[model samples]
Target: MTALPETTAKKLGLVIDLDTCVGCHACVVACKGWNTENYGAPLSDQSAYGAAPKGTFLNRVHAYEVQPDTGAAQTVHFPKSCLHCEDAPCVTVCPTGASYKRVEDGIVLVNEDDCIGCGLCAWACPYGARELDKAAGVMKKCTLCVDRIYNENLPEEDREPACVRTCPAGARHFGDLGDPGSAVSQLVIEREGVDLMPELGTKPVNKYLPPRPKDVLDEIDVLSPFLAPVAEESKGLAGWLDRVLEKI
Candidate 1:
């Protein structure tokens, strides 16, 4: 069993705004594209055109229609991936020590070379973040785009995770949450961000900003305009035209 570091130097993670995510799935696509080409072994698809199709993806977006207490029902787009928890159960459960959390950045990663393709890490993750790549014969999850974030060859602006960069709605943010002065930490404090199932004691690094109440529109009667008379009588030259038309 692998033991987690007592503390990480920095908690690098994401702050996802539930209210602003548009459910466009841009992040999902970006994640899949970047990971397949740049990261470890390429993500695979099993019988993509067959009746049962399966594919490996690092990120996924789920939408839910929720009714708030004071407003109309609204759809919330939730993006889910590995949280890089402080007490990640997946790390502890790995028999081969393939899964480990980085003490420098607090990012949980799996060493594919050391992986035995055991499903224990997937079973241990509470957020359902781990997926077994059938083609590669290894368990895979979001690395927070470790390769891209640290690649100095890329532009400074492009150094962040691909999902954060491609999010059209600007709902995803990446930063060091451990620093109180960081923008992500400030955003979480202002938005009252909540953890995903805090009761489980995972202490997930990723935070989700709750969706704000939507404005309710007043009900309108569609037939009201047609039901009312346009005018009591046709007046002036219009009345004379009306009389002539009636005679005709």
Candidate 2:
């Protein structure tokens, strides 16, 4: 394992908004498509033609049912990927020195040539960001779309990661977290963004914007009070609904 640089020049990372992510897997698809093609390794799937299939992906979205103390149940769509931590456990555990964090930009990367499929990095990672491409016999992870972000051949607007570019809800964002004036950093400050598993001490660079609390509206009457009297006059539920519609 190679020692991390004393200080990284730039902490380039992502800020994901849980409130806006719709669990549509748009980011997942776009991530897989871009990384598999742009990155050196080809992310392979096992038994893809069969009923049960699994594939290596750099990014994935998960949905969870969250119920607060006093409100309706809500679904939180969470997008997970490599955080490019300052003291990345995954990079430190690589015996072959294949896993390393870039001192210039803070992007954690795996050198496929040096990887021996030991799976230590994957196990060391608390965020499950490192994945083994069983078919390719090496570890894989998100590189923060390093290729596209630095490619001068592409249009300025298309320079961002595919996941950020393809998100229909605009839930994903990419920028330098090291610079306080950066847009992603301002978002973290404004939204009170948090790190995932901060206790583990990996010092993940990526941040997540927590879901904004929703205001309860059940107790508030949205319709006119005259509709209430009309509801009492109705004979059944359908009749009450009809009366409410008529009142509207």
Candidate 3:
């Protein structure tokens, strides 16, 4: 097991609030924007005008319509990305030492300069976090913006990853998961946050809080002014107009 560094600043991570996440792709776009420009290589799209066009993205949002045994209607939009696990399977499976966990902090990163374009890391990751960088002939995944977060030239507040900074609903938070007193740690405790696919025992550092229970629409009705009874006309045009407005 990789241990957290004591001398360096705490290892930070994201704690996503699933309850507040509206499934907006803002975070995804923000991640692509930052990584494509700053990371080793840009995520690419191939055969733009072809029928089998495809692209690579570090983060993706999955929309699931969940039907519970209790007959509740819920739509769960899970935003999937690299978990930066302590026992990262991707790192262990890499034959070329391209995938590694930082000793300075616990952040998992790929050494693009040393990569050999092996697909072992992608296959080992159950979360589907690793994607091949065809242009660079290596695997690519989220860096958590290592270059930006630790840069002294950047404003202290602007050091966090772009996704967390661009989240409009405030559903994303970045901080040290190692420190129990950190805001992210406290939020996880308070919200009973959960790990994705915990049965795999990857020990993911990032956490996701489940959405709260909500009432679903029970029925749909259509009202027509032409279908109303003639006797109801005595209620006056104003009252009839109000009912029509309400139904509409």
Candidate 4:
């Protein structure tokens, strides 16, 4: 009997197309639903039926208004979570072995069993990726759906992170970033995607492509007839005489 080839180690990562994302929050909801069922502890909500309700989520979408004086206000909706950085500060800061980067796939994961909830890893991260899971008393963040992507029972097409699968606007893409031929790598090259807070030098594996600039309304207004002088007023002998004298 022939044995199957061993699965090669891959640097799995995500490339988010900010230009294409519609801020639908489908990816956030999908992540919550999947992680709740698969992970060690569910993301629970406190005071669900009362006021001051809150819950823990591995991923969250944030909306920001970016205004330029020369253009219209741009509404940018970006998802925030663990970047699974190449030089992950979270891993180095952990006194316990709880926070770690997977050598096989480059996913930053917290071993819940070993976590003491020191919150050091949270502070080490510049992107605000890590969050304390109050119910579990451990730090939690995006896992890239590690359990689902490698499942043998799942079809090849279905083997992807929940966020990528559920993104309604096709904003999310998942693949081996280390491979130059990979789709995610190609996208990063084509879009000139930027890392958030690059000055921190976490060397984040995740990439965010900036939104394309929209047309300015003020430019259109400048060409309207209401703003321009009437052609007839500048014509005839008076206009000709004025034009001739002005040339001097």
Candidate 5:
């Protein structure tokens, strides 16, 4: 069993705002595109054109329709990825020294070259955040865009993970969770960010800002304009079209 590092100065991780995510899947595609090339191996699909196609992806978003007793149904978009926990179970279970956490930034990563494709790390992770790389015969996961975030070759503004960079809603943020002064930490403090499944005790670095309650729309009849019958003044389809055009 691999032991975790003693301590870390920075808990470099992601902060996802559920209220702002639009379920666009932009973050998922951005992560896939950048990691496939930046990381050691390509995220390939097996039998892509066949009846059952399976592909590797580092991040995934899920949409849920939630109904409240008091209001209308709400659609929540959730993005999931590695949390880079302080007590990461995935690191402790690795038979080889392939999985490890960085003390510098608390980023958990698998050494692809040393990995044996045993699937132990995947099983150990409670979040189901890992995948087997069939092309490379190793375990693979989110690297937090280490290559891009710290790359001197890239512009400083372009240093963040592709998901954070590409989020149209600006729902995703990346920063040091360890520092109270950091934007991510301050956001978490202000929004009361929560950890997923806190009972498991992973001490996950990533935090999720809950969706703020929206103004009640149930009281307003949104379909009122369409609900009312077409004006009797308009006789037929052509006449109705003309009337609609005239109103505009």
Candidate 6:
């Protein structure tokens, strides 16, 4: 079994803004592409064009229609991945010590060489972040774009995770969450960011900003003015045309 680090040098994680996510799935595609090409073994898909297509992906988005106490329901697009919990059950439950957390940045990663293609880590993960690559016979998961972030060859602006970089709506943010003064941490404090499941005691580094309350305009149709008739009673040329139509 693997043991978690007593304290990581930094808690590198993501801050997801639920209010801004547009359910575009761009982040999902970016993550898939980056992980497949740069990180580890290529992501495998079985019967992709056929029924019940299955593929391994590090990130995924789920949309939910939430009904507020008083207004119309709203759709919330939730993008989820590995939270890199401080007390990760998946790491501790790994019989082969393949899953481990980095002490430098607190990123939970699976050593594919040590992995025996066992689904124990997946079962232990509460967020369902880990997936088994059928073709490589190894466990795959989100490494928070570890390679890209640390690569000196890439541009300074491109150092973040691919998902964060490709998000059109700017819903995703990546930084050292351990620092209270970091931009991501400040955003969390301002937006009252919440953990996935606090009761589970996972201490996940990732935080989600709750969707803001939307304005309810059910009392009146604001477009009624433009939709109203321009003239209830016509005169002159308009009156002649109306009369002719009525006569016909």
Models 1 onward score TM values of 0.86, 0.88, 0.81, 0.82, 0.86, 0.87
Evaluated at residue 207, the lDDT of candidate 1 is: 97
Clashes of each: 0, 0, 0, 0, 0, 0
Question: TM-score order of candidates, best first?
Answer: 2, 6, 1, 5, 4, 3
The 0-to-1 C-alpha lDDT of every candidate, in the order given, reads 0.93, 0.90, 0.83, 0.83, 0.91, 0.93
lDDT of 6 by residue, 1-248 (tens): 38899999999999999999999999999999999888778889999999899999999999999986876789999999999999999999898999999999999998888999889999998898999998999999999999989999999999999999999999999999999999999999999999998989999999999998786656777788779697789999989999999999
Error of 4 at 164 (Å): 0.8
lDDT of each residue in 9-109, candidate 3, tens digit only:
55568898888888998989998888988878788778757999877788888888878888766887788888888778888777777788886677888
Query: For residues 1-248, could you state the per-residue lDDT of candidate 2 as single tens digits?
Result: 46888788999999999989998998899999888887778888999899999999989898898987866988899999999999998887788899998989989999899998999889999988888997889999998889999999999999998899999998999999999999999999999999899889888899999999876655756666646454345568988888899999
lDDT of 1: 0.93
Using alpha carbons, what is the TM-score of model 1? 0.86
- In model 5, pairs of residues that clash are none
TM-score of 3: 0.81
All models, RMSD in angstroms = 4.9, 5.7, 6.0, 10.3, 5.7, 4.7
Error of 4 at 89 (Å): 0.6
- Per-residue lDDT tens digits for candidate 4, residues 1-248, read 01111332777889988888888999989998998889667777778778788888878889999988865789988987788888787888788788878778888888888889999989988888788877888888889999889988888877899999989899999988889899899999999988889998878889999998786555556557667555645678989998999899
Which is better, 1 or 2, measured by lDDT? Answer: 1
Error of 6 at 29 (Å): 0.6
Q: For candidate 4, report its TM-score.
A: 0.82
Please report the TM-score between candidate 5 and the true structure.
0.86
For this target, which candidate reaches the highest TM-score against the unseen true structure? 2
Off by over 4 Å in 3: 1-9, 215-248
What TM value does model 6 have? Answer: 0.87
